[model samples]
Target: MSRSSRVVFYSLSRKFVQEKQAPPKAQEVIYYSLAIGHHLGVIDCLQSRLECPLDGFNRWVAQLPSGGAARRKLEGLGRFGEICIDSTHTHLLATALSKAAPLLTDEQQSWSQRLIDLLQLIENEPAIYLMVRRRDG
Candidate 1:
């Protein structure tokens, strides 16, 4: 992603935090797609240390408006997508998650920490890996 892309993402995340309203469907799709892509990357990077199940990941993905299609795309990947999310992006996401944590239901809160941890891990690591799925004919 370019510098501008990062700025756009950070700006969008900050907006999400401040407004406490869901972005439009298009923005939501982009936001969650990038967020989940980065998350899956973090999980893959820390595979030995983490135990993120696909079912759980899918559940989170299902939160998106187009979640069913997103989950199908993820399933097609057959493995982690390789993408990178910088610390700035990760930090913004972490902040957003933390601020929203208190409002989450018990079940949602259970996995929230895992999400926070992954975001924090990206900060410590020199580089964070994220993935984008590709389709082959």
Candidate 2:
């Protein structure tokens, strides 16, 4: 980006980062709105420069940090990855299952189950000795 654009982005970023806290619900709305605004600005800038509306929000979602105590609580379960991907998919899916299940799907689910079964089988198998010489033998 040019120096002026970089300066504006940094200024806006600092404004959002340094804002005063609000009540729980208000805080959520405030931060989310700011994040959406930032994302839009980024998308517009990138599209203008690249000559395409870059459809990489999935990649962006993966790289965004999970913020706040609530985020930690949600992530404590194995739900964060599932929820994050689901949320990101909502923005791009627009009714396409392929886009919706980029990382999870029916066939992949079956494959994952089969792989788990194989792992269990391997875990239950007895060890085999190849070559050994015991001094006491």
Candidate 3:
């Protein structure tokens, strides 16, 4: 992603947090999509350290924004999608994800870090690997 794209994303994230009233559904969706994509990068990083198959990665991508325009623009660098769909190029993906971590809020930061910690756990824990699913369909 170019500097301009990162600027736009940061603007959107900050706008969502500063809104006086409830954000429009589209804005809400954008925030969560970006947040999930950012954190998934972190999980990809942890996967490489363990050298385990990230079988659940694709399942996460399937839940993200799938519209061609939205998918293409939001994922200009193909951060989360590439990591989820293809496992070989994960090191690059992890570096991209770590950069995005600081853009998240305190709550979002904690939630995302939890996923990172879970991936680092020595014992295999199914609960830790579970992805968050929104109820709206």
After superposition on all C-alphas, the RMSD of every candidate to the true structure, in Å, is 17.2, 23.7, 17.5
Ten contiguous residues minimizing lDDT sum, candidate 2: 128-137
Q: Per-residue lDDT of 6-102 in model 1, one digit per residue for the tens?
A: 1000111211222345457756665555455534221222222233344444454454334343334334434543223456556554555566566
User: Taking the tens digit of each residue's C-alpha lDDT, what string does model 3 give over 59-118?
Assistant: 222333455332333243234422221222223333333454655555444433543443
Which pairs of residues clash in candidate 1, taking residues 3 or more apart in a chain or in different chains?
Answer: 81-131, 82-130, 82-131, 83-130, 83-131
lDDT of each: 0.43, 0.28, 0.32
Model 2 pairs in collision: none
The number of the candidate with the highest TM-score is 1
Which residues of candidate 3, in runs, are more than 4 Å off?
Answer: 1-95, 122-128
Model 2: per-residue Cα lDDT over 31-89, one tens digit each = 56655654523211110111101122222223223453322322332332222112222
- Between prediction 2 and prediction 3, which has the larger TM-score? 3
